[model samples]
Target: MKQRGIWPDEFTFAPLLKACANLEDLEMGQGVHKHVLALGFGRFGSIRIGIVELYSGCGRMMEAKKVFDEMPHRDVILWNLMVKGYSQSGNVDMGLGLFRQMGERTVVSWNLMISLLAQNGREKEALALFHEMRNGEFEPDEATVVTVLPVCAQLGELDLGRWIHSYAKSKGLYPNLVSVGNALVDFFGKSGDLETAITIFNDMPRKNVVSWNAAISNCAFNGKGELGVQLFDEMLDEGVRPNDSTYVGAFACCAHAGLVQRGGDLFDSMIANHDIEPTIEHYGCMVDLLGRGGCLKEAHKLVETMTMEPNAAIWGALVSACRTHGEMELAEYALKELIKLESWNSGNYVLLSNIYADRGKWEDVEKVRVLMSGNSIKKAPGQSTIV
Candidate 1:
């Protein structure tokens, strides 16, 4: 267009900015913003909103805010853009402050705020906002239900999650909306309502890999490890390609059931069959499975030969296995790696101390205690709940 002498205007600027956002080309987006200013389109509300959207989409919150602050007049869409930018950038305080400053809000505003709060680990506040949204004039939409359901999942708020399920049903939202359906499965799974989770998963008109993962994970969560493995087989038979998370759930199921051979096969096939590389989590699961099955030597070998540098989790799994199987030497080796990765972890010291005590090595146990005292590391107190 520049070569053809067709200069850009405000009408052209919005789409150009949107294209930049879609492509996530921040440099090109900023160049377009400069052109907008030079072309006198800076004063246009739509152009300004587009600029804000471009910056926010690129995770450039400060730049987005500068564009937003300079806007002479702002609309609900602009406010939503700013809130989304801050929320997504993990600036929940700024997001909430901007939200409270809005004189008027659309449903998108409420949903964005709730989603932000829920995503940032403020489940209680997110739930409270949901109540406020319910009493307001606007009705919660599919997006609202999808966003809030995860809060219930995280908090294990079974009752609240059930209510959301009913609401989704009443609104005819589920089955048609795959995301809401998936969220329902996840919520029920996390809340220990495995039966309901499986029911929801089976009832969904459509199922994705996530849906399969949720159902399989719920089986593992309920300690029905074999059942979880079966579900994984069913998922593969149904032709849903598994991702890394899918394997995580599957390996966990095998670990819980002490299905060493099955776990080994699954781990080996991750790269061969699925073209998915085994992550540290997968390697850790294999170690735990081997350790629990009394394959301590194999577990240690697996850890030693892991392609990636063994992290705390991988070493911790081997350490745990060593303790369980009475392999003090391997346990010590694993403990050494654990200390290197997480010297500050009191659990590691405690585990090592317990291992030595189990073998009647009071001197080693005393040394472990002395080390703990010298490092000033204390075991975190345990907590329990009674129903």
Candidate 2:
């Protein structure tokens, strides 16, 4: 169109800019912005929104702000976009500020900030926001229900969660929106209401891979590994494609049940039958199972040959097994690896020192004490609070 000397309209630029935003193609977006301005299309709200979306989506909040401030009229959608962009960048305060500044807020706006707070560990604030939203004109929607259920669960507000569950059912959110169902299942599962969680899962009008993952994983979370494994098999039979989380849940269940042989078979099936490469979580679960079952030699071999670096959790598991099995040398090695990862955590030094002392290795214990002294590390108390 440009080659033919035909000018592009806001309709043409809207999707183009949106595509740039989605792709994170800031340079292309900038080029489009320049073209939009040159064509005197900047006055159009659609054009302005597209430009803002492009800048904000690329994490260039400053540029997005410049465009946003220049717009004489900003809709809820544009304001929500800014909030969401800041939220994605982990600037929750900025997102909150934007949200508060909005003269009018939509459910999407409330959901964005609520979800942001919930995800960033501000569960209390997120729950507060949900209550605040309840008093407002924009009642809780599907997204609001999904976001708040977990917060209620985390804070042990079981009664509140039950209320939300009822609200979801009354609002017709439960079965229609699979996400709401998934969230309800997860909330109940985490709260140790396995029977209710399963009932909700079974009653959902539809189920997806995520729904299945939640059901299986929750069983694992509650140490119902046998049931979780059964759910995994049931999922496979139902033709749901299993992803990495599915395997993680399955392995965790087997590990919890001390079903080493079944875990090994599932791991083999993941690789051979499903073409799913085991992730660190899968590997960690296998190591945990092996260690718990006294398969130290095999766990050590698996760790040594892992394609990725074994995280501190894996080394910590090995250290635990070494302690249980009286493998002092392996304990030292695992403790050393853990120390390298988190030198600030004083538990590692304390544990290693205790092990050395138990074996009458006074010299090694002395070295560990000296090391702790040099690093100014101290043992943690039984519990601590920020206050």
Candidate 3:
């Protein structure tokens, strides 16, 4: 309060800076930095850490690094913040470098590194880091198990996931916390072991929306759409409030099962009965459901009436449906919209070109080829794996 001749102290500025970071108010953060300097608190370690955290939280990695570099002495917490900042800002290389440079690291450091790698699609590297952590005498905690289990699910490394499961059980960590149980359910579901997922779901001491949504999504994704719909009803009957993700999963099941009327009913019920507004994803599922049942006109009408602009995925789905039904004209319309939304995505170009080639439209095919060449869009090689 400059008017009152009072200035905030380091303790006051610390939290104020944190608030600015959370709000992503870079200008206010800079003003607070000046206040810290004016109060002669610039050399304070806690305040410096607060500044680094502020910059990092605002996605200002360079500014965060500058604050970190100016610190004469750094502690474990500072190192953790820097590592987390780089990792979250998509500088995984810098994150890993800082992680390796630490002379001494706490379990939090290890967990952060593993989780960061896993989330960035480096499941293999995440697993290797977990093994390295074990060899370094750091005991795996509940947080570590929760972090690495998803990596196992993504890579379909069921064996590694099982090992983590066994470790969790022996450590008396399984089914106690919903987070760990949710991860186990997702892992089992992704690994094509629905039985185990169901068992874990049944045995959990307490079930949350995430637990139910994970099981429901697993069913929908694994080709058991009818089962997924059944579970959706069960979840609602048991008085669990369905979230957007739950609705998405249920809609996906309906689409896959060709339950057009049922999908429409659920879409209406989501807003009228449940008071949950349908999102773009829900609309996309409706389009797929109608298109799959040879109701392309209805799907097109739904798209035209969508509250939000249809994204590339929805248009891509419609294009795919048109191709399946041999409706070249409709496919061309959807393909044009998809290309406009994602010009760099070569898959859209390739799909449109193939549809034209299939229908003996040589001129259209040649046009697509020439466009691809001009854009330097090379088709990615197709790869398949048998599980």
What TM-score would every model get versus the actual structure?
Answer: 0.89, 0.93, 0.88
lDDT (Cα, tens digit) per residue for candidate 1, span 189-282 = 8888888888988899888898888888878888889989999999999999999999999998998998999999998888899899888888
Give per-residue CA lDDT, model 3, range 306-380, as digits (tens).
999999889988887887897888988899899889889888888778777777888888888888788887776
In model 3, which runs have C-alpha deviations exceeding 4 angstroms?
1-5, 339-387
Q: Model 3: how large is the Cα RMSD against the reference?
A: 4.2
- Give the runs in model 2 whose Cα sits over 4 Å from its true position: 1-6, 373-387
Backbone steric clashes in candidate 3, count? 0
Measured with C-alpha atoms, the lDDT of residue 369 in candidate 1 is 76
Error of 1 at 240 (Å): 1.6
Residue-by-residue lDDT tens digits, candidate 2, 1-387:
889998777789999999999999999999999998788888989888999899888989999999999888899999998998898888989999989999998788898899999889999999888888888867788888988998998999999999999988898987899999999999999999999999999999799999999999999999999999999999999899999999999988998998998998998999999998888888898899888888988889999989899999999999998889888888888899999998998888888888777778888888887888889987689632111
User: Where does the lowest 10-residue lDDT sum fall in candidate 3?
Assistant: 378-387
RMSD after CA superposition, every candidate: 4.1, 3.3, 4.2
lDDT (Cα) of model 2 = 0.90
* Candidate 3 positional error at 285, Å: 1.6
